[model samples]
Target chain A: MIEEVFAVGTSRIHRVDPRHRVVFAAVFSVQTAIGKEPAALILALAAALVLVLAARLDARRVLQRSVPVLAFLMLLWLVLPWTVPGRPWLTTGPLSASMEGVRLSWQISLKSISILLALMALTATMTAATLGHALHHLGVPEKIVSLLMITYRYLFVIEAEFTRLWRAAKVRGFRPRTNLHSYRTYAYLVGMLFVRASDRAERVYAAMRCRGFKGKFYTLAVFPAGRDTVWFSLGMSGLAIAMAAAEWTATV
Target chain B: MDRTDPIIELKGVSFAYPGGPQVIRHLDFALHKRDRIGLVAPNGSGKTTLLHLILGLLKPSEGEVRLFGRSMRGEKDFVLLRTKIGLLFQDADDQLFNPTVIEDVAFGPLNTGKTREEALAISRDTLHRLGLSGFEDRITHKLSGGEKQMVAMATIVALQPEALLLDEPTVGLDEKTHKRLIALLAELALPCVIISHAFDFLSATTDRILTMENGRIVLDEEMRVHIHEHAHKLGSKPHRHV
Candidate 1:
């Protein structure tokens, strides 16, 4: 019941090693951070776009996910320039958006979008588990890896339970009008869920023991790129050339 | 039955929650190396508790649990004995905390100190055997229920345990998957104990039937006798293993 609600669509990106895309995404994120040139930023943005297209991700869906991140960045963009006034780009006689401040905010937004896009492409084609394994293979500790594993494994279960509770709310006339009193509304449900989860944890622990679990957590290692380290390195540097160009432009 | 040489021997095993009433009371059973047993009970009857006793995760409130004829008197014995037991819990999510099918399948062997290649080989062999070759890279949480169970079983298979303990092995499965599971269990050469409520499945896959009532083994018999004496079974308040 935890696997899926449907069939995963077929695509080339889907067939690639999960680590390949995640590493590329992460590398791109680092490049965006270090590079200040418009060329590097633009190239980073281009790389992210290519991934989205290659993954066959729909723009609308991507935008829907990007909206919150985008909105958060925009909020920062609006607030930072206005509050941190410097030598006036626009001001209320005292606290004004400086020229450099405005430019910095724009740069921040652009950089964020680039980073978010890279992550989006990575997550779009690769499921959460694959990404976790990739990170684990790249030398992430088992404790953290297992936490991510458990989170990915149980996320749907929790979501399903949430959906059920949501439906229950709907059935019991739980429409929250703009002026409705609903702060402590689902708190009881949350408490009940905690109790249920604890009980489940106890049962799960019992089950684990029954199957011979000790304190030691074990797992298989499938780091495909590690075996092909030289090849991956060459490819990364090839892309870094464009990143270098972008960084050079940002400073100007 | 040579009680002295039992693979898993339990004697007068009793357990009471720390702050609650006595849960498991005066239990006794001994499993042979290749014996296939089933544990059936209702929702709170200490079936899980009993299993934990054998696993050494929980010490009995009274009496003792023995593994390979050695009493698990301390934490070390429990640790040493756990390697021999392969447990597949009812929830695949908990048992399989690996990202992909292959990695999850390889986890047990890897922890036991198997190299990457060795782990990969065992993972591949088990997945192929379980009919999950195409799913090596697939997200574990995205697999179908039946497929998840298959992968979960593969984890045990890769672990190479002497005995397998499966809790509700095929619950939440479709009828087709259920039949397939019973056949798979029956074909597995290793000794396995299945804790399930599915009477037909238990009868089909296991050589022995066991029921826990009030934290004790109220019924332990061959499958044939179990069905034959179904009507005269005592106080139908089904045992709760959980």
Candidate 2:
């Protein structure tokens, strides 16, 4: 039910060390998110596009994945241009679009898209399990890494349980409609899902204990450090620094 | 511990959940080496609770749990005992918490302090032994029910546990997988306390059978299959009975 559509690949980006990808994704995302200059944002976005191409990701799938962010950006475009109280760039029929507001909205849209594409091309190229291991190797807290790994593992199980419960409801002449009864039925279904999930959590914990879990999750994954990983890290670092320099120069 | 000593011993064990009635009542049980025992019980008969108590997942309010002739009183002791006694949960999903099949299978060995390389080797070996040679990189959740069950078994067996506590191992299995499970169980030399409802499966795999009711063992007998030929009504043809 939970598909990792982008995880399976045989490209240069896929072969890079997950740790390098994770760290560079963070560095590039942070730089893009904080950068105010159009020049830096455009550079970041272009770099992200290059990474996407290098990863050989399907352009159609990438666009499909970007739909939610694009929708959010559309909302921002609708609201921001008229609300920020600045010199009017356009006035029509009692609605005025402010220059500063439009600029702010544009910057946010660029930041969001650049970060999203970069993350998809880098971190999403590996499975969640690999990402968890990478985070651990990067000195993320053990508890957080454990939570990520365990949550990823059981998300599918809980989804399957929800599907079964929904099927049972459907088989019992239960057609959801716009009514109090339907609302109550959906609430009960969600409540039961939570109850079942918690019950399964207890059983899973017991099973872990039976297998000698001692409050520490040991990962068998190894991210081998190679020349490509080193070069990728250096190259990404250089690009990130360049983006930051452009943002500073534009600010000055 | 002597070879004759019980691998797992429960003495006067009685347990109740907080604010709940007793699920296990003055239960005394022992599992010795070379004993492949099948335990049959009705729903809510506390067969699972009993296994949990033995594994120290649930503590007994009245009695003590002894593992390998040593009394295990606290969490620390059970941590060590768990490496020696593996329990296969009825739901494979509960047992497999890792993303990939090999990682899930290697989890036990890793938890027991094996190096990553050693654990991977053990996991590969275990999967190979279970006829899942090429399933190393498969996502655990994407596997079929029977395959998941076998992989769960591989996780437990990878630890090289001395005994196994299997809860309803044959549930949700197809005929072929069920036959394969029986064959696998027969091949394992470890003593097993299998809680199952399938009488024929128990008879085929175990040497001793136990029936539990009301949180206690009601019948203990040698595992035997009685076959007879019988005719139904006047004109019906005779058929072999199981």
In terms of DockQ, which candidate is strongest?
2
Tell me the lDDT of candidate 1.
Answer: 0.72
Candidate 2 chain B: 10-residue stretch with minimal lDDT = B233-242
Quality of candidate 1 docking, DockQ: 0.35
DockQ of each: 0.35, 0.81
Q: Could you tell me which residue pairs clash in candidate 2?
A: none
Tens-digit per-residue lDDT, A57-123, candidate 1: 6677778778898889878886888866567877576567888778778778778888887777665
Models, CA RMSD each: 6.0, 3.0
What's model 1's lDDT at A99? 81
* Model 2 global lDDT (CA atoms, 0 to 1): 0.88
The TM-score of the first chain in every model comes to 0.77, 0.96
**What TM-score fits each model?**
0.78, 0.93
